[model samples]
Target: MKYPTFEDVKKARETLKDVSTSHWVQDDLFTWKWWLLLAATFLPWVIWIKYRDKERTLEILCYGLLWAILASATDVIGGESLLWGYPDKLLPMVPPLFPADISVIPVSYMFIYQYTNTLKRYLVFSLLLSGFFSYIVEPIFIKLEMFALHNWAHTYSFIGFFILSLIPYYLIKKLTIKK
Candidate 1:
């Protein structure tokens, strides 16, 4: 059997435009959780856009993308490993709530970087803040039935997330410094 090339795949998709308007609407409705998650995830970016200086916005966007990728990777791993699960009501997918884990967490890191230029300081604040949000705030989500933890225990996972946040903080500091 032969695999389709990118162009072939695109052509196939274009030719197979059998999607109905009702199906599109249903898909949109099904993805409402994703939309809400996106809004919540982007709230930090919106705030940053309003309050942040123009010079730093690009830098923050870069860092946000980096952290978002990392967070998404972690979410994929965690979900595949049965570490945690999100409610069907809260998300259309498993583990991550419409990429919120990736996007939101990274933006939060960008906020820390914006305020604190030093790696040590950023790491400290990032760990504390992420820890608080992951441990205290997120457990409430678990309790409220928004999500469920499978194999991953919250105590260690919370600490792990705090440490994980430091990685990007240190990396950003190193990359941003002038030689």
Candidate 2:
């Protein structure tokens, strides 16, 4: 089969403009609501990173980056599916994908990983943390228009995020053990 030409791809992208325009709005135009949500989402990460061990700071940063990507991917998919949404006012004038929600989640996970020593204990704690965040913090976000759940209402089902977090933790532990 012949590949589509650049012109054809350009036309297709233009056609998709309406679907993507909301993501391109000016960032500095944020409202008070946006600032409040941003503070709540980002402050904890800043405080935790400040107190983190110097030697392990790089490790935590790396893990934070990885989990940020994971969370971004999930957020994108969820946004496309109408399972959730973020207000355009909440994002800064940067990469369209750079939202506060994505930035915060991985750092939170890194904090959990750093504070706990054992996999079993970390897993349990992480699950509880995920449940609390999902049930409590997320609903407030929902109210603030940072996100919107579609067919599925948010619940304390830490199983999914726990499993997602477990994979990296397990791999990290195994590699550290081997070394």
How high is each candidate's TM-score? 0.72, 0.74
> Candidate 2 on 1-179: residue-level lDDT in tens?
99999999999978666444554344324667656656756786778768887888767776666677666676667666766656554544333335444566676788888889887889788888788767887787777665566755566235556766876676666655632
Tens digits of lDDT, candidate 1, 81-143: 888866532333234454466556776777787888666787788778777777886798787
The TM-score between candidate 1 and the true structure equals 0.72
Q: What is the C-alpha RMSD of each candidate to the true structure, in Å?
A: 6.3, 4.1
What pairs collide in candidate 2?
none
In angstroms, give how far residue 162 of model 1 lies from its true place. 2.0
Model 2 stretches astray by more than 4 angstroms: 1-28, 37-42, 92-97
Compared with the true structure, all predictions reach lDDT values of 0.68, 0.66
Error of 2 at 136 (Å): 0.6
